[model samples]
Target: MKSFQELGVSKSILKALDEIGFEQPTPIQEKAIPAVKSGQDVLGIAQTGTGKTAAYLMPIFGKLVKAEGVDPRAIVLVPTRELSMQVGEDIEELLTYSNLRYASVFGGVGWTKHAELIEPGIDVLVATPGRLWDLYRAGAVSFKKVKTLVIDEADRMLDMGFMPQIRKFLEVLPVKRQNLLFSATFPEKVEELSHEFLDFPLRVEVAPSATPAEKVSQYYVAVQNYRTKLNLVSHLLKDEETFKRVLVFCKTKEVAEGVFKVIKRKSEGEVKVLHSNKGQSSRINAINAFKNGEVRILISTDVSARGIDVSQISHVINFDMPQDYEDYVHRIGRTARANEKGTSISFIAEDELFHKDRIQELMRADIEEMPMPSEVEIIPISKKEKLAQLREIDKQKRENDPDFKGAFHEKKKREPRKHPTSFNPKSMKLRKGRKDGNNKKR
Candidate 1:
């Protein structure tokens, strides 16, 4: 329970922290700030919501705020554009009253805008690998003056195929700068990179890696198809007593919107969807509104699962299971923050069964299966209705299929060809017969 003031932070930083209501430091922050202040390399192992950004940012600010020249003394690298924006914003706020100059560089924005920021003496450069490399190639960056380097979300960089770019950045950057590596999980690749990058790094971990939130009550509901999933999700949301601010995550942007439409029908007007398919301003607005409690329900792809710094999220509903088990951890992490007990309810259908099982094994968590609501409450489709649909399918088959049950005269069914030859009109008149008079003779 050490306070930020007791951690040897200067009076100015203490004043700033107190103004921001940051009195006590979290476990990770308390342990890491001292090491980082001492200029020792740090390999931090902490989850996203544990105030990791501040754990590193506080120390960087404490050191860089008093810096004289702005030759990119500190470089903080993030994995995604959203994360780059978030971290840069966090730094900008803490350094608002100070004379420090910071820059945020990411893709999807014009390179010209970034060129102006980097050209000036930026004391702290918050960038992604791709843009950083691009700027370096254009001779707009001078890495020789960097004093501290941070690679936030190192595991994601490796996952997104940025190792080569990371290698190149390392090769070009100054050798004697401090390195800070932060990630929730330490895969083999991240561990290997830390060895190559950091010098005598001190490892600091506040929570066990890969462990889901304890405050998050997690369970799953079994269903049959997307239609069933939709029905189940809508039914779950109708119970206002349980779902307050629910976040539904799908694997892709299309599924996010698709599920959003299905759920919005029951929700009337409280539901909103966010995905990459939307324009940048739209997505940013949606996320901001959700974070501000303007939107109580948000349906999004797992892209928002990473580095979205929103607290007070009551429940996280998984409309579609995640492809990687690690994603399950990140998805649930969005909820159950700020010591607030939350729930992670997953909708497990036939298509998501395999993914659900793998996620279970990865987290080493035994998921309690929740039964669907009573048949009467949820209005299950009756057996008679299902049978009638099957009957209609059979009737359609009999009518449309001329040789439905007979063995194919040709061994292979006619499949759409990759590059089918053109059918000549003169040679395609009839198939060995004239049907008009020949059928009457038969």
Candidate 2:
């Protein structure tokens, strides 16, 4: 309940926050700002939409005071280009009353443009791991002036396989700089990363790691098959008044494209689809459109789940369960952001029930199951689809229990066949002759 002023935020930053209508600090910010100001390494565990970005940035801004050199004094590393852009925007907003220079660099655009961006010098630099490393190798940026290093969304960076680049950064950056690592969830791998990244860091957490936002009303609808899930989504969107802005998350690009096509044909609103394969400009435009309220619905894979920071998303629909249980938290976190109440509806097929159970276990709460709407058409599962579902279920079981050999595995087990070289034509002819002689004698 403490105000930003009471938390020891500077007068200029306070004015900027006030202009932006930010009256009070969120739980994470309230606890983290002071620890960060202490100049000790810090580890933060807070879900998305809890103002963790400001928790670190505000204190860092207070330390920077004014721009000093051409090279960046602080580097903020994120997992995706979208996140890099978002953090850069946040820095711009926070430094509204100051003269600090900052630049955001990521792939998808020409490196020359980014090189031009940092040429004049910047106080803060936000970038993805690969792009940052590339810029450094090209001699466009320097680490000697970087007094603070922030690895935001550490879990996502690890998930995206950026650990090697992160380690390389650790090797190249100054050892005397402050380290701040933040993540939505703290898995075993993240915990290991923390040990390597932080120096006796003070840990701050707003909630238990991986817990979904309490304000989000989570629900699930059981469906017969994939097509039925699509039917249910289209049917639910028919009530446009309640489902004003929605994010539909799929497990893969193909499924996201299918959902996008179905929703576009059935609904009368602008819809966009985003995946890794999409062109970078197209993906950025789609996200910007959705954020600006020009597009009502967006279908995307988990790649965009953690990067999106829109606060007014009315609903989050899981067209397909995420392969990683931790992603379920990030997907739902998209809706209930900025202390706004939101809803999350998941389509649970037979094959996804095991994943649903695992996610519920991680959240320590069950998602309310809803009866299928009477208007939605339920498509029957084909034999091929049914077999595929069974096989997927078997795979899930084997992942949890190595001793588990499901029915499909049992059926697939067969005796080894003879090699082509093992054929014997002479023996076959002799046996045939003996059989003919016996028949003639008879």
Best by TM-score: 2
lDDT of 1 by residue, 155-195 (tens): 88788888888889888888888999999777788889999
The C-alpha local distance difference test score for the whole of candidate 1 amounts to 0.79
For model 2, the superposed segments whose C-alpha errors exceed 4 Å read: 410-442
- Residue runs of model 1 more than 4 Å from their true location after superposition: 375-442
Model 2: per-residue Cα lDDT at residue 278: 93
lDDT tens digits by residue: candidate 2, 283-349: 8899899999999999999986557889799999999888789999999999888899999999998
Evaluate model 2: give its TM-score: 0.94
TM-score of 1: 0.82
**Model 1 misses residue 75 by how many Å?**
0.8
Question: What range of 10 consecutive residues in model 2 has the weakest lDDT sum?
Answer: 429-438
